[model samples]
Target: MLTSSNANKKRTPNRLSQHLDVLLFSRTRLEGIKQRRAMWTDKQRGIRLSQHELLCKNSCGYYGNPAWQGFCSKCWRERVRPAEARRLDTRESGEVTTPTFSKFEEKKNMEKGRRINTMRRLFWGGPSPPKQPSDSQMNALKAFQKLEPGDFTGFLKTLRSPSCQRLQSRCTAFLNTMEAYHALQVQKQSDLVQDFYQSFAEYFTSFSEAELTRTMEHVEKLIMTRLHKWVFCHDSCDDEQKDLTLQRRIRSLNWVTPQMLSVPFPEMQSTITGDPFLPAITAIIEMDAKRAPQDKLVCVSKCSQHVFEALSTSNSEPANADDFLSALVYVVLKANPPRLHSNMQYVIRFGLPQSLMAGESGYYFTNLSCAVAFIEKLDGRSLNLSPEEFEGYMRRGRAPAAASGVQAAACETRHLLDELMSRQERLDHGVDALNVQLQTWVQAVHAQIDQATSQLALVQEEVTDISLSASSSTSSDSAEIEHLILTDEHVGSPDTDC
Candidate 1:
């Protein structure tokens, strides 16, 4: 019994030593795992700090947003401030508004900003002081600001005077026109577009299928011609793009017209209609019906005509062809509200005058009569010209030398008419010489006055045809003689006799 007890006691000591060795191994593995985890944690912390350094570090200078997730501190406050204010009045929060300034006001604001900035820089360190306006520029600005309606005549004279030198030109080229004039012009065209509807009353009553067909054909030609012209001006649109754009426009026009025309204009008439397939047919019918009295001339799209048609439309009217085209696109967008573009709209709103005023590229289509009409409405006289002299003037002034040239041309015209009227010369032979002399007189006018160039081109073309036809005449023309006698007094009014 004593021997068995001794053996058991020896085995128990061996078991205790084995248990201690297993505990030591386990502790070593746990310590190694902890060290690795600590190293990994340190690496992650370094990476997060580096990423933070790269992002916008500027504080928005608002409260609590730095604690919030994804919100910019300054932006959130600004956005919320308007909304919070509306808590009292239910008005919707408006966008952060930008203040607009006139040239003089803008200059003043800029100077103020510079002063503030300069003071800051003096305290700290920054850019040099801002450049100041010249004395002439300042004086010009002051003078233009003080100009009243009654000052219009005096303004022109002053601007033209030696004192202003080139200051008037510079101010006009920069500050005289408002910054938004181009945008305003475009908006005006859009507004006046509805004035054209009255002209289409005749079409509403009688919508012919043949007329519709002709309109479609005409519109297709119009589209191709316009696109071809556009591609020439905008070289950025490559040949492939141009072809794709043309096809898209053709398809859109095809789609849009049918959709619009198919809807019955119950207001138009009881039975009149056009092809649903062609928008041009629809437009042409309207255009044909809209024609003004042939006796006197009228262009519905002209600023004067559109204004006369609807006084309120001046603000809404489209400025030019681009404005018209854009308005059509806006119309299409509002109706369907679809994701569109490419093949979704007409390349241009169709018309002779509409196409002509598109830009410099469309200048080829300019009708001199239409241009004369337009120029009359566009700024009439330079600020330097006297209102009395300007009002009575024949040509819109180019320069002092140019105006004097017109007087010279008129004097020569009087001499030529005197020779023609004296009847010392035969009507047959003298007419050619008279026509040649008249052509020379206009050519001289064209050389001196830029505006007269277009006038001369139109006049010369008609004169050449008349001179050739009249050359074979044999009758003693007493009526023409009377007209020649009257010509001396109205030499400046070239179209008066006609």
Candidate 2:
């Protein structure tokens, strides 16, 4: 209204001079960031007081000045103390003395009699006086005055004479024969020093010292004394004159016979009194009932003649009838509740027959032909049997007619068709004896692979003639190293153009 109040008081001092130049440029950038953080904290406390005065002058030889205060003004003027310099030279020189005790006991009794006369002149042999008679001790006293026979003044006037009482009875019989030859040389040198300290306490008790000198040379070759003459007639006989000459040579011997004293001895026939192998196993079951079913030979000749007369009247040893018929055919095919009929499940469920006779069928067919000839010689080198386990052991010895009866079904169908055609002819003769032992083990592995391929072609022709004589000695050492590199390049050629 008064000319628009003079242009709005000139834009109000230009907006209060732009807020006093942005509050004096934010108070001069906060006093230049507090004087650059107080000059970077006085340059990090002057680099930590110059790294603590160069780490106290490289640790303790301290050329100091840690802001100077307690000593160390570079080793405080080379410090010195020696008891305050010997109390200032004993207060500038002022002396005093004292020391008596009878002149120290006459200087300790003249140093204790000069160390007991120098340890009695080093233990007695030092007096230095006696050596006078030398011309070889006056020629060994004139060779004991020509072997002195009666002279030490007529042996002291013949020791008052009677011919010196026969020279004192021959000098008391030569000192009782030199004390019985020095008591038998001190009892044979105390039994050779108690047999060398009981053989060095039985060779160092438990060896070492080269195993006690090889066990004292194997106890001096096993010291059995009488150094031999048939060990000194067997230690001079005497065990009651060798048991009265072995009971007068077994009462004038006569080899024993009468059928070896009526046999028995099948291990003393189970302590005798009967069971003589049950009358030779009932005469081998009446001679395997007169043969005939392909001539029943499984009779094992009366159990191989009563196990060869019980191994020749029990001297025992025999056994191996094919390992006792393969342990009696594994105790008649896996024994388990079987061991030959406890009425073997009512004779394998009713079919009986085997009325074991003929010397219990020749001891049960010589223990089943010694266990089918020891499992046919261990299945002729291990095929281990198959053909249906040998047709189930010939159909378990066929017989089960509902537990056999009707008068033992015609001797159990003729002993089960003669033990099923003698076990199908012993399993077709054990597959023709294991195909003739696998063609004799393939002709002994083709004659040992043709004698190991002719000894590996004569050891590869002697390692190819020792690698052609080591490649002709490495081509004659590369022609003598190319004739010593052409005679060292023709004696180091300097140009005589050969």
**Number of the predicted model whose lDDT against the real structure is largest:** 2
Q: For model 2, give the 10-residue run with minimal summed lDDT.
A: 344-353
lDDT of 2 at 272: 34
Residue 481 in model 2: lDDT = 99
| lDDT tens readout by residue for model 2, 1-498 | 987888889888988999999999999999999999976554333101122332223244332322222222223223422333345445544573323657545655664566445333322223332234445434433333333332334333433344234323433443343334443432232222223323223313433444333333222222211111112112222333543443333222212111211232333224333223343344334432321211132333454455455444444555433333332332222221111221111111111112211224423442443333333233211222345543443354433222333454466557668989999999999999999999999999999999999999999999999999999999999999999999999888977665
lDDT tens readout by residue for model 1, 1-498: 999999999999999999998999889989999988975564332111122321223443211112212233234334654454345233332354433446435655665577456433432234543234457645653554445533435556655665455433433332222232323332222112212212221222233433432332332232233233332223332434644443344333322221121121122222322222133222222322321111011221332233222222322343443223222332222232111221111121222222322332222112212222222232213212345644433242324333453575577667668977776557756888989999999998877797677788999999998987786463447667778878866785766766
lDDT of each: 0.36, 0.38
Where's the lowest-lDDT run of ten residues in candidate 1?
291-300
Error of 1 at 98 (Å): 38
Our model 2 lands, by Cα RMSD against the true structure, at: 51.5
